[model samples]
Target: MIVQHNIMALNSYNRLGTNNNAVQKNLEKLSSGYRINRAGDDAAGLAISEKMRAQITGLERAQLNAKDGISLVQTAEGALTEVHSMLNRLVELGVESANGIYQATDRDKIQAEVNQITEEIDRISKSTNFNGIKLLDGSLGSSTANVDGGSAITATQTDATQAQYVGANAVLNGVTFASLTKGDVLTVTVNTRINGTDSAQTFSLTYNPDKHTQLSDLQDALNAQIKEAFGADFKVTDNTQVLTFEAKEAGADKAIVSGMSWTVKNYNDSASGVVVATGSTSMTETKGVDAYTTVSGFDGGATALTKTSSSADVEKNTLTINGQKFVMVKDKDAAANVNKIDSGINVIVAKDLDQAAADIEKATGIKVAVDGNNLKVFAPKGAASGGAGLTLQVGDTADSFNKVTVSVDNMSSAGLGVNGLTVTDQGIAADSITRVKSAIEKVSVNRGRLGALQNRLEHTLNNLATTTENMTNAESRIRDTDMAQEMMAFTKNNVLVQAAQSMLAQANQQPQQVLQLLR
Candidate 1:
């Protein structure tokens, strides 16, 4: 009775449209098989999964990087192996040289080979590289130790006597002396002469002050004339009244006196026995008082004179700093012999003596030893005397270098000297090779650690894959529509739509009864 519009058909169409949309969504879910097809499907889950995906990818790549590091270390180790082989061969050559069987010529040939091997070492040090980074060359690394700190870094050379061979000059004055004059003879009348030793040579001298300007001046002139004549072989002595001349050289009998106005008494005698005027004096007592190399004579005993050599009055190497030369000692044991370094520097003591020694050598070209609580730095006896200037700095302390720490671990057994890879007849060369190998091993072990970390990453990746699968499945249950249930609903909705259309047609037909009333 209150039929205003076909509201039942309108309601049926609206319900069918809604059920169709649901069915279509279920079908899409079945086809795609993922809960989140886009950001609209699940916002928070998509964001978290994306982050996890990036981490998994980075971990995989990191593992590859670690593997590459291992390869580089292995390559360097292989090259070092070849160097070790060549070193062993050089050691064999050194042994052959030391046998004393080889002549000078054979040794020369061996030296040539040694030179070639040294060239090879230089070549390897320069040419070896990894990723454009040189590995065996000492130039590759920056010094971690700071030399400018408050601690003094020093180096010492070992041999003190090698300076003589290097043309070091002596402090020279104009004065010189003759070692001996041969003319005077005191006949041994009390001691009977042997069968063939009765011959002698004789000479005499009379000192006149009017003939020479001063006695001291005459003595200098006489000393120089004598030394120029006999070099270091002859000796002279004066007893204030008469001057005696003698020779210590075998079969030496005569001397010509120079720069003196004197007459000979008995110039002629048998030459079977000779006399020498060798004079001796205490050199230490005459230091700074008399000119060096002055000789005085005793009445009748063996006389000694200072043998003239460049070493007799040599000065120490002049070390200059800040435009001033530091006072140095010819011998390190003399009074106040230490070279006074003026600059203040911070000291970063290394963990052990060996490391400290190496640092000092690198910084100052001098080796150092830990003496009790102090450091004793010595130049290798004859190291050439030039060094990079040291700057006193206090800012940055070396964090990598440890301060004087002693542990009970075994020594590294590696060095560049007798025990190292430069193998003469000594095992030092082998020791250096061993140390290098050990270093290589340490790098290799570090690479192994990286490899282990890479393995862990791989395991994590696998776990992430399994977790991703499970999580995706769980999300699917929450967001996906079931294809079986949706298909049934779609089919039922289609049937209901057709049945509603039929019932609506029948209801509309009932409204056409006015035509039957007109008939």
Candidate 2:
């Protein structure tokens, strides 16, 4: 018997402490309603659960984001609905004016109504707000383009091809105007003239005169002697033996009014009846009238005059005036004229209004109207209303409407309205209404798509909830302790502990028996 070592007691105590720890852990699992409360409980389960929880939270938030997206789309669609309605009303008005029988006054009254609706459209485009952001009027789009002279201009166009010219003279005479073409349209105009006295009367050529060969080509030129005497400004052209000089710029009187005049003998056809002189005295006539100045008919048999003297009539030679005989005239004027007023409802798509306006002006040769969201430009007047001015529908992207055509004037010869307007044959308002209806349909389709997605998300959320519950149950089976089973084990261990104590006492009695021998 070694009193130094209490081996049995130590063994029993260690076993008790370990059993108590097991009991405590089971109790914790049952009470906490979780399989893994701490990393020590089930490190792998804890890690897996944490990741699942994060994903669940993120999925919920994603669902919320999708809902918000739908709302935005719906808001835009509703605004467009109103826009469509307005367009329908305008279509009806267009039909009312299609009847040619209506006088201008009647048209003006209808125009007033049209103008009012236009104003309303502008108001809507400017005022429609979605979560503090504008939706329908293209407010949230922009792009930057650089032009010459170290300047940058930002612009937006429904057509990607539309470009903004930031600098001066970026394009001259319609060639590649910029170092980077970037799909910009350029129109160039050149103003030049022909001089006669300096050389000979000459005609400038074009690429295809066969098509427009008969077009007039008259220009101003300087006379060799008078050009040197008076300097660069003394330019002249002749009409039937009469000479007229033009100044660099128009003033009180052209130079011919104050300059001396003479006629070479052979050049004056008055000597022959080939030409007649009515308003002159000698071989030369100097009424000092400018060319193409609308002149009234002759006063009583005093007919329109022509040069009548020709000094070298007997000799045959190529006719020359100021050196040469023929002068080519080219007409430089506006191609056509038609005025259009748009509400400029799409300014939001542009980086800046001024640059956008400038681009439209340059490309279309029309004045841009920036009064509101409606972009308006004067149409080529006399444009066959049929193929001329079409209001383009801008698509979702910046380039959607680039190629869309707008030919309002050419809607129909006989028209009540294109879509559903009540006008005579040939009204454009109806067609515009049709277009708006199409847009509405598109918006409706998109909304339907959102609705479907929302349904899917709801279903997904339900499935995720069910899966999370089942997964928790499975983990519990592996890591949780049943309280009833743990209580039964604790009761058994308690009985054992008491029995062991009793046995230990009995063993002590046995040791006392040995003590009797010592007595």
Candidate 3:
């Protein structure tokens, strides 16, 4: 009706533009084979999909890690198989030497073989390695000490408890240490003993998304802040994606990480690292160690120590030292509970407590139970093995619940207490056989532990496969395009696009017809 404002044509043009946009969106979804390619398509779905994708990736990597752990266990167990054979052979030689018919000269040859076999045992324990990591040594296994039953000739067993004076330590694995993002600010409150006085200090670090994107970036930055605030005696380390803090000086009440709290703006924001720890997260810190509370012997009895004194007649406490003939002298009011003497041999006393081989607990049964209230210490208890050092990360989570740890006992000749055994004499040779049998039991126990580790890993692999499949299925449902459905949508939108184009053309013509009014 009016030349100045072509209202009909404007309506067609607007409809055409809107229809074309729908067509473009349809093409994007169809060609890309994705239901939601951008945030505009489905913002909530995108976020959920991304988080699921990350979990899948982590689960996959965890499978590989579990595989590596199996390999390590296999290598250690296989080497132990050989050790088992050598130990059995040692027992055979010992029994042969024990025969009364065998003369001293013949027994010497047996002794020579025993020495070589023992040396070879030591060699295997020292040199056995898997990927440059020692397997049969005391390092990878839990620490065990020989619990002597009072006398040198008594039965000995392995005990795995230690005093909690190693260090104040803990791993804050609850937080996905990689997740700290830009504008994410966290404060660490540290409580420590300064000159035996309890002191508290707080330090905070802010994450800049522009700078820290790598896992190491987050760890290093946070660690630096912790170190600066915690001072020189403490050290922070990241192991297997775990943040561990330990004191360089070993003792009770050394350090305590009182609390850790964070404030994050976005889940991932600008940080390249995936944000895992979410929502006002905090870790409750506990003290790591305890002082000299109660000491129990290896045999579930009271602990005893033999002190060698310059003055022999110091109150005459008759305590036998390793079955060696020694006179025990009382130096104090304290006395041991168990009496293990032919007559009246009392346990030794101190003041006269000069000292012996600091035994590293080889000749003593020193049990230290931790009192959690006193100090911050992390004392790893020893086990049937000499040390438990290897930790297996079998799950995607960074917590103790998701880990499997194994103990590889030391299988060396000395470790089994056969290094000193001799096959040259009949009585001694018989004793050697007894000891070798004991050694065999130790190797068997070690192998059994490794076997358990392998089996557990196998089960873990099965679980991981199942979980990965399920998660992938869930993510696909939320993300992947339904091709048939998309096709139907595409067809409908394409038709609308064509219709809009034709209408737009007609709209232009309608404006032209208005000019014919001038004619």
lDDT of 3: 0.54
Model 3 / residue 76 / CA error / Å: 0.6
Per-residue lDDT, model 1, residue 363, is: 35
The clash tally of candidate 2 reads: 55
lDDT of 2: 0.34
- Best model per lDDT: 3
Question: What is the RMSD, in Å, between candidate 1 and the native fold over all Cα?
Answer: 29.5
lDDT of 1 by residue, 220-271 (tens): 4444444444342334444533333433343323221121121111212221
Candidate 3 Cα misplacement greater than 4 A, ranges: 146-386, 515-519
Q: How accurate locally is residue 403 in candidate 3, as Cα lDDT from 0 to 100?
A: 85
TM-score of candidate 2 relative to the true fold: 0.41
lDDT of 3 by residue, 229-270 (tens): 554343555444344444454344542222222112122223
Error of 1 at 484 (Å): 9.1
Decide which is better by TM-score, 1 or 3: 3
Give the Å shift of residue 144 in candidate 3. Answer: 2.4
